[model samples]
Target: MFTSLRLPQPVIDQPSRLVLRLGLGGGLALAAAYGLAFAVPHVSLLMALLLLSKPGPALALGKGVVLAGVLMLLIGSGVLLVPLLENYAVAALLLIGLGLFAIFFIGTRQSHPLLSLLLVSFTLIPVAGVQGQALALQVVHALAGGVILGAVSGTLMHLLLPDLRQLPKAAPHKPGVEDAVWLAVRGVLIVLPVLLLALQNPALYMAAIMKTATLGQQAGSLNARDAGRELLGSTLLGAGLALLAWLGLSLWPSLWMYTLWITLALCWLGLRLYRILPTRHPPSFWLNAMITLVIFLGPAVQDSASGKDVLTAAVIRLALFTGVALYAWAAIYVLERVRLRFHPAGPRNGVSTC
Candidate 1:
């Protein structure tokens, strides 16, 4: 009896340890993601995955990260005749067409799925002149940091969510032509918003429309009413976290503490919000405005950007950014709800084979 009991305790303890390690790893990944974005907010791998998939551990997660990183590096380096690939619109259209063909005929060869992801990433490549070696190096550095972070975070998540084997199977082992098309469509939808944003702001816009579009695709289709409920839950959680972090900053000038406090607060809010506000409703602009206020207030007070002056410049900048991001999310959420209500997508949610 003692020996049997010992086995069970060890088994239970092992997974728990793994979970802790993975979660820590994920946290580090998030930090790296944030750091990289500070330099070039476009193509943010952190926000990409966070906004899309359910957090979990999968063996392939690391591979996917490394693969994406290398691909981005290669493109940044101007390798594989990508730089010479003329006619930006023409080329993208061609690739989309080719992808469509692959979906129908080849039906997602083992290599197709990764290639599809690679193609999606290619949308970030500027159609202008070639990039210099220096630019390539910087891009590589940022991508490497993000990839490492994601690998660690994903590994940690795997530990926490140990039943990854039970992940939903792809639509069909055969070929997911419709699924791929849907993915491509999703990519277009996600990218379109950023593309428009870029037209509006040429300075800070990193031209990440494609990445955002792909992210929306990855978020999967919001078909049923439940889908709205989930986004509602997610947005509220993100909002609450953002608010708590602001509170911490207002209270003190500790960066690390603020970050940690916000992370925990977000987790708690995620659980609480999901349980309470279980329905998706259009959030009032006032609610968003309040969130925006907290974001600025926290940073300005915590950072002490204003020593001699009563008001800090950082507060102003923070307010601008917070207001924009919050409003954008709110608008997107409203649009999604509208789309769901009107056209109403069919029940086709599942992992993409291609």
Candidate 2:
């Protein structure tokens, strides 16, 4: 995408092209998905956006297709569980906890980076305000629609635009049962409390997002200090830009104008997000901040916002990701140290399980 301009030192550092690809592909996919008219357009596009973060193929082409199918079935199954537990709040919450545990456990493996999206999307099927067979159908269709569209668009993107970083493949390995269990424990520790907080709020307006952001970080990949600084800077800049664009729409006061405003805002935001991902870009939080806004504040992007509303949301989101980063780093650092002390010669595990 930057053929004329001399690429930076790590040619792969720039990913503005990827964001553009996501915007175009995600737009087309949303157009098709919205034809259903009853589906949540933002949900599908949001899924596509999350999937865009995942660079390589989805679980190997053939396996990914199978995995997608399995995910649909599992989503349907989750829908059934909701009604069965509606009369029992305890069971419902426990089910949610168990599901969170599983998502974290599987997510510990680098092989399944997108599993966090898959798991949360499926788990939420129960609470998607659906019931019975229709619930199953809707949940399956919703998730499948998004996942298929994302995968197709991603494939086309790879075919047309060469990957900025053609990092050579290394053999992927599965985490051991012990590693999975420990990771799940840490995730549950961090998530269960947050889940409880969300439950306390009647709307649960931001809980799922917070949980997803929290688990999105894997252990050992980025240090907490770097993650904190980057998150603070990026959230401040990106939120500033987003809130400003939001203010512009109130002046124009037309749907078309608002649409134009959103398109431009996303373009600018996408550039910032991509710039933040480059090697010089600090690790962690910028991308999470971007995604968090989409999931939480997307529907209102083109609408007028109260200064209080914007400020409150921004502060809450900044806190959410920052807390997640610190927790992730602490868990990794503490666990690794304990493991080393107990078995000083054991093979070192570099990955974080936060």
Q: Which number leads on lDDT?
A: 2
| Cα RMSD, each candidate | 8.6, 6.8
Give me the candidate number with maximum TM-score: 2
Candidate 2: lDDT over CA atoms? 0.54
The sequence of per-residue lDDT tens digits that candidate 2 reaches over residues 177-198 is 6766665665566555555554
TM-score (C-alpha, index-matched) for candidate 1: 0.51
Over 19-62, each residue of candidate 1 has an lDDT whose tens digit, in order, gives 34333443444455554443332233432233212323343565
C-alpha lDDT of residue 299 in model 2: 37
Q: Give the worst 10-residue stretch by lDDT in candidate 2.
A: 299-308
Model 2: how large is the Cα RMSD against the reference? 6.8
How accurate locally, in lDDT, is each candidate? 0.41, 0.54
Clashing pairs in 2: 219-352, 220-352
